[model samples]
Target: MRVDVHAHYFPADYLDLLTAHGSRHTDIARIPCAGDAEGDIDARLRMMDTAGVDLQILSAAPQMPYLEDAGNAVEAARFVNDRYAELVAAHPGRFAALAAAPLPHTDEAVKETVRALDDLGFAGAAVSTTVLGRTLGDPSFEAYWAALDDRSAPVFVHAAGRDLDSPQIADHGLTWIVGAPFEDAVGVLHLLRAGVPTRYPRIKFVVPHLGGGLSFLLQRIDDNYLHYHEAFPALPSTLLRRMWFDTVGAHAPALREAIDSFGADRIVLGSDYPYFQGDLYTRAVRYVSEADLPAEQVRAVLEDNVRAVFDRL
Candidate 1:
């Protein structure tokens, strides 16, 4: 059961909505969204086949159209989740979907999350690191976190519109040079420091792109904590071992380091399919296979861990 846990899909109607209403945080003009409905599914499946992926779990692109009002956010989430459910029902074994919820609007997000799980039969939910320009650790989101923890569903935190106005974005382009990984790292650090895992232990988080440079930056974060314990003492776990990572963009050495830091069971296979970085599944898997990890460990990451996290499907 070769499962690619981290993959994205954009239904046409959703993209149309985004295009109709301009995004506040992200430059939707740059991000290529699926304009046609059937083409998106066809392209995704073709890429999965080319990459030798047996199953691809589809998640909404994290930079969901921003809802100016909280009420609209709720309605938008319902619409997105319904579309995702339709996709999963139409294509049974070939694909599964993670529900999209209206975030920064906790009540609505939680309500939609329950519907996605109970009625739509989605495996889990996908949330961006931040909602309405606020990080996941915001006090308003405690209820949302609690609900996800109660359900024991995994949340896929994708790199979305964070620090869009940062100096890096001005200097370099958006794809993989800096913005994506930087946003992911910042989100992970914020979640850990905000005591998310400590507060909601059962709510598992899967960070994509090899945890977005977290494996290399753990020591730096710990060093800063050592120096400034009084100021920033809320380091949730001991190290990067608590969270799960995906081998989407990690190379051989990086993957080995992630295994050493987080262990094999904490790692899973992910491919940012239908994106320019989509080929990472074939490329990174081949690289990691050459590292001579035991076959069982490979299988656990490539298949079993996904099943464990996405058991609802």
Candidate 2:
């Protein structure tokens, strides 16, 4: 069973709410959302069939509005979670959703997360990499982290946007291309330095985009820790291994490096589906197949690891 863990779908009601209320990110208005399988059932199923994907662990587009009024954000989150529940109920085996939450609004976000898991039957919760300049490692989220850890829930950390105010890469479309992955890297680094994995050992985190260059940066991070131990304490290699990564990097070399760094059991298949970067669903599978990995390792990447991560589904 090939499970694509990183697919995206934006509910129409959520879109309408964002559009009507004036989106914080202007680019959202220009994007084609409803046309994609945000709420459509047949279209997504057909694409999954074509891609040889048995199931898609769906999530809202990472560009969820975190800056909206708390009340509006909570309402939007409920609408999306309800829609996800409806979809999962309709197609029990074909799809499972990662519930959206109104993050940065600590109390509301925590409440929505519990509701999404307890009542909505979602696989887990999906959150942006940063919440209003606060990374996931920020101390303010202790309660939220404790809740997830207590439930042993899997949290999918997606890149929403990057520091656009920075003068460099300000004009180009680098925000989506470069900034997105950079945010993922920064988030992972913050989580590592803040000792989140060690602190919340039971909380399973699924970091996107080949762990935001984590596989490659592990040496640098650890080497730097030796010099800056006081500033950022060192983390054990085992703790780092506890985090899961998705197979979004289509290139053979990159995927090979990820497998070497993270091991196959820690990596799951991901096609940033319906997004331009997700166009390589079949090709990603093929890349892993042709990488000369053991047959079992490939199976782990495509299916087993996902089931293990989102076991509640």
Candidate 3:
């Protein structure tokens, strides 16, 4: 079965948190929240079928309700996660989810992660590249990471905002175009510098946008890190191989590089739905076949890799 690990959907009620907390990013009016209602989800299912995606794992990314207020964060996590549980129960194989955890509040995040994975049966937890500028490997998130690592949970990682904390990119209208992949690269480098992958070896970190050009930058990252931190456990490039990257970008050279750098085992299917609708959405899936990979590796990217990364699914 083909599984897309990088699809997105936002629950309608959860969007209320945007106004309630004064969300800094995400244009509310333009959100493709068609999956909020059951009727809209039927449409999503039809699109998935048309795109040859047997299952689309949903996540509320770039708009994840990471409110600073613990109470609001907990509330937001509950409602959104509960809704995902509902859809998963209702649809069975057609949909799965990476539950939202209230972050920047470590203990609360831990509780929600436990509940979501241990109780709710989500495939994993969703987190942004940074939690209000706090790196995923920041000391504050150690407990939360520990909990996820202990549970052997897969964490779906993405850039939090479209422009991704940049002024130049936003002004140039290259926000989603250049910003997303740029943030992906920065996020991976941050985690590598902080040793998140080696420290939490059991935690499966699923990243998007062909790892934001990490495959190309691996040598530079290794050289820079080894120059100063030669005593670190291992090269950043070596540790990075442990993580999984989704095949979201259709660039064949990048896809081939990812396969060569990380191996076919770590490349998973990702449609990035709604954002790339109709034919563009289908291309997100079809690109793998067009990349001219072996039939076995193509099947691995489409089906086997995701299941291996999010084994709970």
Candidate 4:
């Protein structure tokens, strides 16, 4: 079964919450397809069919609610997860989901994570590379990490578009173009330095956009680890390999870099959907099938790696 693990679908109501609390850079959350009587699910399904994707595991990222109020966060999270669950129920095999947690509020986020996974039967949960200003490695997220580890949930890490605190990426519209992958790289590296992966071994973390060029830089990091041994209990490359990644950009050379960095068994197909609609979406799925990699590796990235990353999927 071909699964587009990194697909996204924004509910209209949820979009409203994003605007109400914060702009969430609504421009990024905007779906290219025109809205319909059925919320355009039919249009999306047709698009998926054309792309040869059997299923799409939808996620709400970059626009995730990283609210300050736990109460408001819970409400927003429930609304998003409920909407996602409704889509999965409406169309069985055609779609699956990764739940959105109202994060930066640890306890509430943990409760929502459990609800999204255990009650809603979501494959896993999606989080931003940084929640508000706190990196995934922040001390406040320890309970959140432990809870997910206990359930062996696959955590999808996406870049929080508007929340990137870096002044360098702020100007010249770099937020979407350069900020996405850069945040992924910085975010995961923070966790590696914090030893979150080693601390919570069962948590299956999935970084997006070819782990934001980490494949090409792992050796450099491993070499530098000797000077920073006090920060990490394990090698940076070793912990990163334990995480999973997706083929969103579908750059052949970079995918090969990721495979060399961490075998294809740790990679999976991700269309990024609406952003790469039509021909681009088709290419996202087709690239793996037609890559220069070995046949066994191709099958693993297209199918087997998904099962390995999310046992519940």
lDDT tens digits by residue: candidate 3, 1-313: 8898988877666776665776756464245534576567877887788889888888888777788788888888888889889988988899888978888888998998899888998898889888877877688888988898898889889886656667899889887789888888888778877777788989999889989989998888789777876544688778878899999888888899999998899899987777877788889999899998999998899888877787776
Model 4 per-residue lDDT tens digits across residues 191-236: 8888888989998999989898898888888888877664877888
Question: Can you tell me which runs of candidate 4 are displaced by over 4 Å?
Answer: 34-39
Lowest summed lDDT across 10 adjacent residues in model 1 is found at: 26-35
Q: Total clashes, candidate 2?
A: 0
Error of 1 at 139 (Å): 0.2
Over the stretch 1-313, how does candidate 1's per-residue lDDT look in tens digits? 7788877766656755655555543344234433234465676666677767777777875756347677767766777778777777777787787878877777887888888887888887788877767887888889888888998988888877555448668455564557777788888787877878777878878899888888787777777787778333364236357678988775777887888777888898886765543565467555556767888887787778777677775
Better of 1 and 2 by TM-score: 2
Specify the highest-lDDT model's number.
4
Give me the candidate number with maximum TM-score: 4
Error of 2 at 191 (Å): 1.6
lDDT of 1 at 27: 40
TM-score of 2: 0.91
lDDT of each: 0.73, 0.75, 0.83, 0.84
